[model samples]
Target: MLPFVEYAAKGEHTASIIWLHGLGDSGEGFLPIAQELKLPDDLGVRFIFPHAPEQAVTINGGMVMRAWYDIKSLDLDNRADESGVKASAKAVEALIQAELDKGIAGERIILAGFSQGGVIALHLAPRLAFKVGGVMALSTYMCAPQKLVDEAVQPDLNIFMAHGSHDPVVSMSAGQLARDTLQHQGYQVSWQDYPMEHQVCYEELVAIREWLMATLS
Candidate 1:
């Protein structure tokens, strides 16, 4: 299992939300967001923030950082290395299985990510053997999109995608392309765009809270 920081549910622990952070960030980085969410106590939602292993990202002068996959180039089509994505997906699957072993149904678990982390969430959920509650992909794009049709297992996935209109790291168009790809593949995608940058804003959090309630209820 990946090393993770967990915010345990306050009540019966009926559901789980495994959230992934962006490149160069540790699990601790997003712990505050979970707390800020202030999800209702009755929901029993546990948040798991996992740390990506340290790696030398090629685009960043090969300097080692926490990355889900290597960004070999800025080109969206070739950014994420296939092997790295699969390896991280396998690791994330183990985390999901751990939740399952603890008696939480797969459908009660929501997979979410930001930026590079979103890349993993988007890539792994459809390929999973079982269905998850939903996927929250923020400011991210698809990886190996051309192969998604042949490799996908869950065709009825619930996907919520949000991107900043002014995002420079991951352009809004890149995010749109992802939404378009998923929609073309017949997956249900809810798209939202904010007038902000690469980071999340207060408005987005409010929307996320509402979505979480709807998804986990």
Candidate 2:
């Protein structure tokens, strides 16, 4: 199993947020954001940051690195790494179950991530047997759109999606597509766009903080 780092609020906040990072990043990369966001202090939420297993990313031409999945090619039309997606999905599911065992109910847990990690969160959030509090996908998209409709276990899950208008890595269209697909499937989605590119901005953080408070309150 991949290693994971954890951050817990000082208070007894039952709610939890699983923070997943993008490719090439370790779990530590996003743990500090929990502090910067003042999430624990504000909402009494715990955080879980899980590291993706280190492997070669095909999209990067088999470069040995940490990736949630293989990006088979630069050709945007090429196939995705299905095997990596499955493995990461199972890992994420396991993490959710572990949190449950620690007394966090499924509905009090939020699946959140950025980029590749966001892809995983969106992929797994709807499939969990129990409904989650919400999902936050930042600059990401659905990995397997076709499988979602059939596999999703919860159609009413709340989702917050944000994308940079000038994003050069993951196109804004990807985020739009995700929003469309989820709404078509009957999910409640809150979508936002920022004026930046491929990264989170201060305004985006403020919006996320407000969403978290509203959803978890």
Candidate that scores best on TM-score: 1
Candidate 2, residues 24-51, lDDT tens digits: the string is 8889988877777766465669888998
Q: What is the TM-score of each candidate against the true structure?
A: 0.98, 0.94
lDDT of the candidates, in the order given:
0.94, 0.85
Give the per-residue lDDT digits (tens) of candidate 1, residues 130-198: 999999999999898889989999979889999999999999999999999899999999889999999
Q: In lDDT terms, how accurate is model 2?
A: 0.85
Q: Give RMSD to native, each candidate.
A: 0.7, 1.6
TM-score of 2: 0.94
Maximum-lDDT candidate? 1
**Worst 10 contiguous positions by lDDT, candidate 2:** 73-82
User: After superposition, which runs of candidate 2 have C-alpha atoms over 4 Å from their true positions?
Assistant: 40-42, 75-79
